[model samples]
Target: MRPPSELTFRAVALGLLIGCLLCFTNLYFGLQTGWISMMSLQSSLLGYLISLLIPSVSPLTPQENVILQTTAVATGTMPLAAGFVGIIPALGLLDRAKDGMDPIHVLWWDGVWWCCAVAFFGVFLAAPLRKQVIIKEQLAFPSGTATAQLISVLHKIPPPAAARPGLRHRNGHTGSEDGYQAVRTVEAGGDIDEDAEDPGETDQKREEIVRAGWTTLGWSFAASGSMTLAAYFFPVIFAIPLLGDYLASKWLWTFSPSLSYVGQGIIMGFPTTVSMNLGMLVGWGVLSPLSKKAGWAPGDVGSMTDGARGWILWVALAVMCAESVVSLIPVVLELLRVLRANRDGHPEEDLETETEDRLVPMKWVLWGTGGSVVFGTIIVWYVFGSEGIKPWATVLGFGMGAVLSLLGVRALGETDLNPVSGLGKISQLVFAIVQPGNIVANIIAGGVAEAGAQQAGDLMQDLKTGHLLHASPRAQFHGQLIGSVLSIFVTTTAYSLYKRAYPIPGPNFPAPTAYVWLSLARLLRDGQLPAYSGTFMLAFGILGLSVSSLKTWAGLQGKWWAKWVPSGVAFAIGFLNTPAFSIARLMGGIVEFWWRKRTGGNRSANITLIVIASGFVLGEGIVSVVGLVLRTFGIGVASCWGCAEGVCPSC
Candidate 1:
């Protein structure tokens, strides 16, 4: 049989379309909320819908769907480079840009090309690890597994009559009632039977499932779209006031009923959701109050300003940095073990078996990685050289990026979390020690490391989906390459235009991540630390180590408490985010729990719920894109509640 057509024209075109849409959405939201939208599952759902609507195109198999989503994942994630574009440029506008020395200027072409190179390099690094980590180690890449499940359900074919045994067809072909080919099974010493029971009933059931899925999707889309439009017009009416606004008028504790957050919570499951809520409670309900009582915080508990939160963030960052360093110890030891085994002529044992045909070609991986490295080196040289960075520094940055990219892949495989920011901070500290007072070197090296690590982690996730679905890795690689190239143009253009339209760190668009990056760089450059910075850093650093140690012990001992240890990333996010967002996510998880209990763990019902949740996420994202377009065209919705004046917070 001929191999399935995976990297088809229609698949590539649709993937690019979805990628462009998500790129725009992520760029807008990343600047607005300082968070990037997770795109794989959403893209898979949207891809299924598109394939369903376009009859002119052949229906996609599960593998083809995986290819399409792999492309979108690559394209959608490229907007992370907007941090470099928005923040690095904004630093030039600060008071420090007055000594006849111009800060780094990231031209559109340079930015786009650099981002493309970094993304491709990340994919290259991740490709080799697919079999090792995903297949061999059996890491539970939760998002990828969910995407695979979605694709499998969406494209399920009815079973043929021959599946029941004692039935056969002529010409070695067994066909289902739905006109799709089915696998053939033969009996010993028996002739084929021409007539068999019709499989139409199975087809009918499958059709009902498909129909139900689409119907649920339609309802969810309509509901979320209506809510989004209404929220835009009357934000206050849709806002759920969890805590009354009387305590601190500016810090409104209200949830926006974000369908996106709800969808994310349902997908992330109960453990992550509970941990996120716990983090919020500790950060806001517990720590903030204690700090206020001690006069360590300058504002009231309810109305804690960013300045007040800055102290807490300082502690969070220190904890994160320390955690990253500690986590690398095991990674280094593993690398050493592998090298030792290879050197001793005792080749490492294969832990998992896969068909040779299914594996990505080693030659392709080797050549591709080499080519990407050469191209990336050129791009980094051209981009960083313009900012007075030395050639040696650029090479060092690339080396660091390559190392961190592997670490990021390992972390994602183990935890489903990419500590890119923490990795970036490590790069900054390393470069700070090596090339002190060179802000250009610090930012460029840190950006390269973080960007590469992010891409590596993303590609690893995509590969996990492919592994589960038995998709050809080569085709997926092509899809990723295409998407990464397209994203270079789409994301770069979107970031450039958005930055030109809005002022960074302004009232309307507070590029919070950029602010953090610049603040860290300034501190490193000036060597002027905040008051009592050492005290806070040491305290938090010790606390973080202790937490990590306890979690490790629990895991080693196979204790149930390991599940409740709470992710360090969740703690950082809760510290940085407001209470309302966490509450909204917690509500979604609660609903899921209640639903499961009421339904007695019905599989079909749970699948239906997933479809609905996915639809809500897609609808919200689509509406947000529309809102961004309207704003761009000068037909923006005005804020109903004095959000611009800080009287009410935006979720």
Candidate 2:
């Protein structure tokens, strides 16, 4: 028997099941709003609770929890990768409708192929960089760090059988080994010192802690779920006008009463949310109105070429992309500076424990990465050739993706902000220069690069969690593979289902992310920026660069003010998202800061607050997905025309 490790079939299967259920919620919201709740925290809790519920099953081990989250996150985030919401739909928007059918429409299998082709390559890339990024640098991949902490809190009880050989630490024993030493020593036929207290007392104390953790989480979920269900029936509850009903409607200024938004804000935290609000104030309060009044953007609200939204996107991308490149420069140079030292060796490897034995080896990284390039090249040539995507684009896209992903993932690790807009625009520009005028190639190439960036960032986070928990990297890698396979099906089926029931780029689903991509593609295809937005773009780009430089300088000096500086990438997201989103997130941040202060430094209380936020996010997601399934067969509301695509008001 495989010694009760993280790679068990049970954990992977359960994770996939959870991920499948979770995918719908993300798909619904990722298009509806270009954000999805982070699935890691909720899935870890869900897996822990489920392990306890299932009779005769061994309690979920900490290592196994990493696997559970790995699969769940991988599967849950695939819709955006598969391009239902953005890339594919944007492609359709750019290409004229042929006989009233959208070219974005595709069979489920093809959708899977399209997504998986580039996604797996990134997964392979993450393995080699793990030692460098996660271990050596010890950067804070916040979600992964949080997930590891949560798993630790839940698995207070000892593993049922023998513990694995220790993943040796600086003290030659892990903190876990130290904590469980009293119990494990007795189990392993070693004589216990009489002074050592009763092992049963330790178990009892741990049981109480575990009990309290689960109870608090359960109540949070129950409370949030009840409220979410109630709000579902009362659609008015979802929005509370912040600027009065008329102004709220006109300016996209509303306080979303959703706890999910609050939870997201809590995850995002104060500095980031403040920056987002700053962007909203400048973009929505000032720039948008100014542009519209000047007739610079003369089309309807949704028009990409002549609307404020489209004009804002160019300026936002400029700020974000410029900052991403500029900020990434120092980090890239630092890596290059140390490249010789790393090539010689990391002495830390000599200290790594048995856990390293289970890791995805360096050889696999070389073989798998090479294979991915070949595989992706084939995919681009064969699958997308009709649309004008060349094999070279995919090859070069992977090269850019590999380079850019390091920056994106490092950003993700340091700040928990994945700079998707910057990643996409950078990739788009690269392809625009190389494969000029082929919109499909431009878009798909970016998609490929974005996939690498997304997957690389995601996998690095998972590896961080695994490294902390001493989980097998190979096991987590396998979980990622399983999740990727499952994602293809989940994303494809979701696209098919939603497309059948709703217009993708239509009213209810504005596909904010896709619109950005589509509009940018058109400009590149036409070889011109929006008429009057050049000045705005330049001004913001300078602002972003200046801020990045200041922050970087402050960071090196260890200035206290460095932490408070607004992130250029996150600030840019303010333009990408609605003002309402920033308002809600701001409210959530206030709630978190206020509650944390009230907790008076109680760790458990802080955790309980996190549980409440997670509950709200998960509850909303569950409710949204359930309603989507019901409406698929026309089971619920009558004539949801806002959801009825071009049949509705806005589109």
TM-score of each: 0.81, 0.84
User: After TM-score superposition, what is the CA distance of residue 375 in candidate 1 from its true location, in Å?
Assistant: 3.3
Clashing pairs in 2: none
Model 2 stretches astray by more than 4 angstroms: 1-4, 97-103, 136-142, 157-234, 239-242, 340-351, 410-420, 635-651
lDDT for residue 325 in candidate 1, whole number 0-100: 63
Cα RMSD, model 1: 9.1
lDDT, residue 460, model 2: 88
lDDT of all the models against the reference? 0.62, 0.67
Best by lDDT: 2
